[model samples]
Target: MNEDTYNEMNQLHESGGAVATVDQLIQTLRDDKNYDRLFDALLLKKRLEMGVPVVRPTSFDNLPEDRRAEFEEHYVNAAREIGSLHLEAGSIPRAWIYLRTIREPEPIVAAINALEISQDVDEELVDIALYQGVAPAKGLEMLLASHGTCNSITVLDQQFMQLEPQVRQECAALLAQTIYRDLTATIKYEVERKQGSAPTEETLRELITGREWLFAEDNYHIDVSHLHAVIRFCRSLDANRDEVRLATELTEYGAQLSPQYRYAGDPPFEDYYTAHHHFFNALTDTDRDAALDYFRDQLAGDAPDSDKQLTAYHLVDLLRRIDRTEDALDIAAKYLLSVEDQLEFSFAELCAETGRYDKLMEVSRAQHDPVGYAAALVEQARTP
Candidate 1:
C-alpha cells in the first residue's frame, strides 16, 4: 500500500479503533510481499504500542487473564520482530522507533549498537534521548568520548532543554565539560529563562565579542529582543571595535527592513519609526541612496497606509539630504495635507530650510502648532 493509505489506515485505527483497519493493513502486508514486511509489522506494532482500544462488540475485559497475557506477549513479540527487520533492512530510524517500544535497557543498548554502525549518530541519539527517556548524561558522555563536533553539542543542548529541571541541573556540569561549547547552548539556556531576566555583565560581553555576534546569519526565529538587549548593553560599556562594528551592521540591517515587517507583540509604532530614522541617519551617502530607492519602491507599491506614511517621511528626509529640496518640499506639501498634525513640524522645518516661508506659515496656521510657527518666523527674520 502507498504511504498515504498506510497513514490513513493508521489514523482511522487510532481515532475510531476500527478492527477492519488492522485487517486491511494485514491483507496489504500479505499482498505486497516484496514490499518491506518490516514496514507493515511496524505499522501494526505502533498501533498496539499506542494502546488503541480494540473495537468489537465484545470487550477485552470479558476475556480471561490468560488471553490478555497472550495479547500482551503478541505485542512484545511484534515489537521485537519489527526491530530485527528494521535492523536487517539498515533502516536505523525505523529500528530505533521499534526498539524504543521495548522496555528500558534494550532501547538504550540497541541505540548504542546503531551508533556503532551508523556514520552519523547525532539526530538518532537526540531522538532517543528526547523520546525514549535514555540517560542524556550518558549520551553526552559517549558523544564527548567519540570526539564529537558541534552537531553533538547541538544534540546535547536539545536533550538538555527536554530534561526535567532537576535532571538538567544534574547534567549542567557535563555540558560545561564538552569541548565544543558554543552559543547554541547559551542561547538554549537564555531562551528558557523568564522573560526580562537580565544577563550577567560577562555574558553580555561574550555575546557582543563572541563569534556568534560577529558572524551569525539572520534568522526570523531568533528572539530579536535578545539582540536588542545585547546592543543596548554594549552601548553601556566602554566603546570597543567589536561593539561599534556590531552596532553598525545591526543599524544598517534595521534601516533596510521594510516598514511592513512586523512581529507579534512588537513595540509601539513610534519606537519602530525612531529605529528606522536612526538607521537611515547613520548610513553612508551611497547606502542612504539605496535605502531611499527602497523607500520609494515601497511608496509606489500597494503598501498599507501607515507604511506609505512612514516611507514618505523617510523619502523626504533622504531627498533633503541629497539636496533635492524642491522634491522634498513637494512630497512634504502633499503628505502634509492629509497628515498635517504628524508632519507639521517636519514640513515647517523643510520649508524654512528651503526659504519657503509662505508654505511654512500655511502649515503652522493649518496645524495651529506654535513650535513650527515660531521656527518659521525666526527663519523669516533671519532671511536678508
Candidate 2:
C-alpha cells in the first residue's frame, strides 16, 4: 500500500505483463513482512501457472484426477519454501506451522537447537520446543535458565509420563545436576561462613561429611520439596551419568534430615531417601548385593496384595537393569505371570530377551496355552 511500491508494481505490470507482475507482488509482500498473504500469493501464482482453480478448494475430490498429484506436489513445495523463508526471517512459530503441515520436523528442531539461550530467551520458544515436543532438551534448558529449578521440576513432574523414556531420563538428569550444583554452592557457602572458611571440595559427600551441624536443630538448606521431587524424578535417569551420582548425594542429604523432614513414599520406597540411596548405589555398582537384599526383604514382610505386586515389579526391574536377567526372569516368572494387570515387564518378553525360549514353551505348556507354546516352540527352533 506504500506509494512507491504501488507505482513500481504498476510499472512492472505495464512493462512485463502478468507473471512478472505477480513475481514482483510476492517480493513486495515479503518486503512488507506480510507472510500470511505471501503464502497465499505463492499458492495462487502456482495454481495460475498450472491452470488449476484460482480459488482454493476444500477437498481434493473436487480437483480433476489428472491435476491432483501436480497440485499436491506444488502445495508441498510451496509450503517448504514458505516455511524456509519464515525460518530465515527468525519466526520459529510461523515456520513450525508450515513445517508441521508438511511433516518436516527436523528443520524446526534444528532451528530451535541453534538458538543461543544464555539470555533474552523467549517463552514462546520454550512452549513449542518443549511442550510441542519439537526439541525438548532445548526447551527444558530455556525453562531452567529463565525460571529456575522449581519450575523445571514442576514441568518434569507434570509432563513426565507424556515424554518418551529417553527424553524423560535426559530432563530428569538435567534437573538432578542443576539441583546438585546449586546445593553444593549453598552448602559450601554455609560451611565457609560457619568455620570462618573451608577447603574447596568437589562432591556433596565431601562437603557434608564432617559437618553434622549442617543438619543440627532440624535445620536444612534449599527447598526440601524441590529436593524430594527431583530425587523422585531421578528414578527415570540412567545410573551411569554423573547426574545420577549427584542424585545419590541428594538422597544422602535426605537421609541426614530430621525425622520431620525425612518423609515416607509409596510402596517399596516407604523409607524414601534410604531406599533411593540403596537403589542408586545398586545401579552404580556400589554394594549391589546389599541393595538387592534390602529390596527383596521388603517382599518378605506382610503387605496388601497390590503393594506386594508392585514391590516385586520394582525388584525385578532393578535386577534386570543390573544385568541379572536370569534372576529377574526367575522372580518375574514366579510372581508377575498371573497378575492379570497390564504391566511394563512382560514374562514372555523377558524370557525371549534372555534367549530362554525353552522356558517360554515350558511355562506355556504348564498353563495349557497352546498358542503360547506354539509360538515359543517356533522361536526355540529358530534359535541357533
Candidate 3:
C-alpha cells in the first residue's frame, strides 16, 4: 500500500480503538481492492493535500458492483478516521480524499462527520469539503462540537452577521466543542476568492452587524486576521459613524476576552497597531487626543521598548500633523538615539518633512561614536 493508504488506515484504526501495525495496514489495502482504485484514492489524497480540488470521476459509477461497494466502504471508513484522528491534527489528507473521491452519499456523510469531530483540522481542508456540497447541516454540527468555545462563538457570530439573515443559522452544539469555523473559513475563503481586494458590500454586510461574535477563534487559535476582517466589515457597513463605534466595541471586547492579548498594547507592535488603527484613524481630533493621552499614560509602567517606539512614532506624527514640529522633534528624539537604523532613518525623514533640517543634521551627526560624529558633521557641512 502507498503512504497515503497506510496513513489513512493508521488514522482510521487509531481513531476506532484498533491500532494496527503499518505493515498490517499495507497488507490489508493490497488484498482488498483493484490497483486502479487504490491508485485513484492516493492521487486524490495528494491533490487535496496540495489544496487542489479534485472532482469525482464519473468512472467511479462505472466500476463493477463489488468494486463500487469496496470504494464506498473505504470512503466511509476514511471519513470516520479523519474525524477521530483530527483531534490530534493527523487526519487532513484522508478527510480531503473522502470528500473529493467518495461519490457515495453515505461515505460523504461520514466524511462530513469526521470533519466536524476533527474541528481543529486545517481551514483549507474544511473549505474544500464545504465547497463540494457534502452534508452541510451535519458538517456544521460536527464543527461546533469540536471548535466552539465561548471565545470561538464570539468570533463566529460576528462573521455570521455579515451574511444574509437566512444564511446565518446558529451552529448546533451537540458535542463538547462549538464550531464557529463555517464563518471563519468563509471569511478566509472570500478573501482568497477576491484575491486580497476589499470585500464587497454584500460580503461586508455578511461579516458585520452581529452583536454575538464580531470576533471569533478558528481552530484553536485567536487569529488576528479574524479581528481585522471584523474591523473591515464594520467599516464597510458604515465608515462614517459606525467605524468608531464598531472599533470601540471590538477593542473593548478583545480586551475583555483576552486581557493578555490586549488590543491596545499587543506586542510585536505592528499587529496591535493594525488591529486598532481604524479606531485611532476614526477618532475626532479631541477624541484622538484623549485616546493618545490614555495610551501614553499606560506606557509609564514597565512598558516594552517596542510599545514605547510605536507610541513615540504616533506622537511624533500627530504633533507634526498639527504643526507642533518642535514637539514632534522632542518625541522622536526620545526614541531616536535608542532605536535601530530603520527607525533612525524614519526619524530623520520626519525631521526633514517637518522642516527640522537643523535637528536632523544634529541627530545624524550625533548618532555614531565621537570620532564618527565629528566625521559626519564635517561631511554634512561639506555637502553644501
Candidate 4:
C-alpha cells in the first residue's frame, strides 16, 4: 500500500481494528520477503504490548524436525531483532524481552533469575505435560550435571553474586551451585558484597594473597610464585622498557591493574603517564601515593634480594630514583657474591646500568673479596 493507505490502516488498527491491520500486515509481509527485519520485529512488539498473539505461520511441533528447526530459527531471528529495538529505544519491557529472546531453558532461568522479577513464571506455561511438568526441570537438572561447560552457569553466578545474600541463597538452592572456598570465587563474592560488582586490582590484592591470586586456568591448582615475583618487579620501577612490556602482557591476559607506576619503555617521563594513556584515564596524586606505598611494602616483604631474581634488581633502579646510591651499592655487592654464571652476568650489568660506578670498580680491584681476575672481566663489560 501507498503512504495514505498505510496511515489509514494504522489509524483503524489503533481504534479497535486490530484484526484488519493484522490481515493487511500479513499480506504486506507475504509479498516482501526482504523488507527490514526491524519493521516486523516492531510490529510483533506492538502486538505483544497489546496482549495480542500473532497466528503462527507454521505449527511448530507438527512440522518435521528439519522444518521445526526453520520455525525455531525464525522465532530466534525475530526475537533478536525485537531485542535490538528494545535496547535502542531504552523503553522496551525487560520481562517481555526475556520471554521473547531466551530459547533454551537454562538461559531463560538465568535471565529471569537475574531480573528477580518474582512473577509466577509457572502460569505462563503452555505445554502442560512437557514444558510445565518435565522439560524445564529436566533442562535445569542437565545443566547442573555439566556445570563446568555451561555458559549460562557462568552468567548466573556473575548475576547471582550481585543480589542480596538471602536472594542469592534461594536461587543457589534451586540451581545446586554454590560459591565455594576457591579464592577467585571468594574474591568475587566478597567484592559483590562490598561494592555490588567485581573487585578491582588493588582491592583484590588487599583481600587475596600473592599465592591465592596465582590460579591456573585449567587446573585451578598450581603455585605460580615465579609469576608473582615477575609482577612485583614491574611494580617497583620508576620507568623502564621491560616494565612496560610486562604490564602490556599482563593486561592482554586480563590480569589486574594497580596504582603503581607504569613504564612507557622510552625514558623522559612523568610517573603513571603510560597507564593513563592506555589502561585508564588520568591518575590522581592519591592513586600514585597508594601504588608507591604498596610497591615498597611488597619489596620489603616479598621481593628477593638475590641474582636469580633479576627483576628484584630493579630495586637498585628504584633506589637510584630516590638518591639512595650507597644502599644501591650495598645491594649490588650482595648480589655479586650471591649467584653463579648467567645471574652473576645480569647482576653485574644491573650494577653498571643503575650507576653504582665506585662499587663496580671496588669489585674489580685487586683488594676485591674474590680473586681480581674474575672481577676484572665484569668491570671490562661494565666500562664504555
Candidate 5:
C-alpha cells in the first residue's frame, strides 16, 4: 500500500466505525510483498479482534512441555511485534491489546508506552498485568518510573486490594522503599489538594485516620514521616478545635499501629487518655457521661501519680459537666491539691463554678496566675 492509503487504512482501523474499509485494507495489506505493511495489517486485525471474546486455547496448556513453551514463545514474539508497530504509531490502546496477549509482558515497557499515549491506557495496562499475577511491586515500580499520575497510583491501589494476602504483603514491602518516593509524593499531594481550602476538623480527622495509602499494610514502616507531616499540617491550621480533633485521630491511629509497628512512638497511656478526655470534653454533654466513666476507670486503676492527676482534672471537668458542682469542687480539693499547679486551670474553673472565690484566689495566687487571681477577685466581689 502507498503512504496515503496506508495512513487512511490505519485511521479507519483505529476509528473502529469503518469495519468494511478496515477489512478491505487488511486483505490488501496481506497480499502486499512488503513485510512492514503486512505486519501493520496483522496488528489492525488483532486490534479489531480484541473485544471479541475467544475461548482461551485450552489445548495449549495441556500440550507437551516443549511444545507449550514453543507455543507461548510464538505468541509472545508476535505480540511484541504487533505492539511495537502500534506503539510507534502512537496508538496505545491497540498497542496495549498486543501487549496484553503476551502471558508475561514487560510491565515497564508496556506502562511507559501506554503512559506516553494516555493515562487511561497506562492505568488499564497496569491493572491487567497486576490481575494476571504480575507482582504489584514490580508493576508499581515500573508505572511510577514512568512518572505515573495521581490516577495511575489510584489504579495501583485498587489492584493492590485484589491481590492475595502474601502477594499484597510482598508488594507493600516493596513500595515502602525510596524508589517509589515519586509515586508516594504524588499521592500525598493529591490527598492534600483534595482537602481544599479551609478543610474542616472532620476532613482533617479523616485524612489522618485512614489506612488507605500511607498506612497500607506494607506502608506502615514509611508511615511515620507521613504521620508527622499530617500532624504538622493540622497544627499549621492554628485552630484549636481542629488541632484537638486531629490529635484525637492521631491518638487512635497510633493506638491501632502500636500492636504491629514500633515506629509509632510510644506516648504514655495517660497522653492518649488525656487526648480522648479533651476531645470528648470539646463535644456536647452527650459524651460527658462516657468521658466521666473513662476518667473514673483511669483513676481506679493502678495509674502513676501523673496519670492520676490528669485523670483527676478530667473527672473534675466531667463532674461539673453532670451539674455536680459541689462534687467537682470536693474532688479538686481532695485529689488535685498536691498537683495544684499542674491542674491549676481545672481547679480554678471548679472553684469559680462552685462559687468558691476564696479558694480560687488562694490557688491562683500560689500558681502565680495574675489573670486567674484577678478573675477570682472579681468573682469574690460579685458573690453575695
Candidate 6:
C-alpha cells in the first residue's frame, strides 16, 4: 500500500517466471502487519487465478459454467480462513466483515458458542453476535452466562423484546432457562451440603418438598427478586417447556416461605408465588381444574372495584390461553363492559369475535359509551 510496497510488487512481477506477484505481495503485506491491504491482495490473487477482472464485483453470470463452482469454492475457503484468523486475534468486528461477505456465519457463531461463559465474554463479539443480527440467540445465552440474571433481565426487558417476535421469544426463553438453572443449582448445592445426599435430578419441587428445615431460620435461596422477574418472563415460554415446568416448581417453593418473604402483587397474583403456582400449573395442564377454580374464586370476592376488574381481565387471559376464547368473550362482555372507564381488556374486540353486538349495545347504553353503542349498531346491521 505504501510506495516501497508498490515498488517491491513491481519487482516481484518482473521476476514472476515461477512464483505469482500477488502471492508475494500478500505475504509482504502480512509480514508488515498491513492487513487492510492484505484483504485486497488476497482478492487479487483469487481473481488472477480464476482469470476474472480484479477491479470489483466478480459477476458469476459472466463466467463459464464449468469454472464458476470452482471459483466460488476457493473464494469461500479463502474468506473463511481470513475471518477465522481475525476471530483468533479477538477481533470479532474484523472477522465479521469477511464472514458476512461469504454468507457463512457458522464459524464465528461457533466461536462465540464455544466460549467458556464463566470467563468474560468479548464485548465486541456480543455486539456483533446480538445487535448486528448474527447469532442473536447465542449472544443472549452468553450474556445470561457471563452477566448476572438481574442485568440480563433488565437489558432484555428494556431492549431485546423490541426484536422480531421469534427472536424476542428466544431471548425470553433463554432468560427463563438461565434463571431456572441458577436457582435450581443454588438450592441443590445447599441441600447437598446440609443433607448427606440430595436429589440427582434437576427438579426444584423435589429438592424443597420436605426440606422445611432449610427455611427454619427465615433463610432464603437465590435472589427472590430474580425469581419474580424470571417467572414474569417465563410467561412467554410454552407451558410444556422444561423451563416453564421448572419455574412452576420455583413458585411452589416460594409459596412455602415465611409470611415475611411472601410479597403481595396485583390481582390474580395477589398472593404472588401461591397464585403464580396455580397459574403456571393451569398452563402446564397439571391439576388444570384446580388452578382455574382458584382464579374463579378470586372473581367472586367483594374486593375493590378496580381489583375486581383486574381479576376479570386476568381470568379472561387465562381462559384464552387454554383454547377457551369463546369463554373469554363471555367473561369480557360481563366484566370489561361494566368497568368505570376503558379497561385493558377490549369489549368491542370481544363483540367482534363472536357477533355479540346485542350485549355490546346493552352494556354500551348502560355505561353511556357512545362509541361502543355506535360500533355495536353498525356491527349488528352488517351481520346476515
The model with the greatest lDDT is 2
List pairs with backbone clashes in candidate 5.
none
What TM-score quantifies how close candidate 4 is to the native fold? 0.23
Q: Would you list the C-alpha lDDT of every candidate in the order shown?
A: 0.51, 0.84, 0.47, 0.41, 0.52, 0.75
Name the lDDT value of residue 226 in candidate 3. Answer: 51
**What's the distance in Å from true for residue 42, model 3?**
49
Q: Comparing candidate 1 with candidate 4, which one achieves the higher TM-score?
A: 1
Q: Which ten residues in a row have the lowest lDDT in candidate 5?
A: 231-240
- Candidate 4 whole-model C-alpha lDDT, 0 to 1: 0.41
Where in model 3 is the C-alpha error above 4 Å? Answer: 1-225, 228-246, 256-283, 304-307, 318-324, 364-384
Model 2 per-residue lDDT tens digits across residues 259-304: 8987788868988999999889888889889988888888787887
What is the per-residue lDDT of model 6 for residues 134-165, given as tens digits with 9 covering 90 to 100?
Answer: 77777777767677677777766666545775
The sequence of per-residue lDDT tens digits that candidate 4 reaches over residues 206-319 is: 444443333333322212232222232234323433233333343222233232323332111222333322321101122444433433443455434532234334445445
Per-prediction TM-score, please? 0.30, 0.90, 0.32, 0.23, 0.32, 0.64
User: Per-residue lDDT of 78-154 in model 1, one digit per residue for the tens?
Assistant: 66766665666666566666566566246545545445423444656644544455656555555555544444455
* CA-only RMSD, every prediction: 21.5, 2.6, 18.8, 21.1, 24.7, 8.1
TM-score between candidate 5 and the true structure = 0.32
Tens digit of per-residue lDDT, candidate 3, span 184-299: 35544555554566554432334444423433442213454455434433322322343444354444434434444544433323345343553344243435665555545544
Top candidate by TM-score: 2
What lDDT would candidate 3 get against the real structure? 0.47
RMSD of 5: 24.7
Better of 3 and 5 by lDDT: 5
For residues 105-188, what per-residue lDDT tens digits would candidate 5 score against the true structure? 564344443443332335555554454454455555555555543433455456654766555544444333332343334445
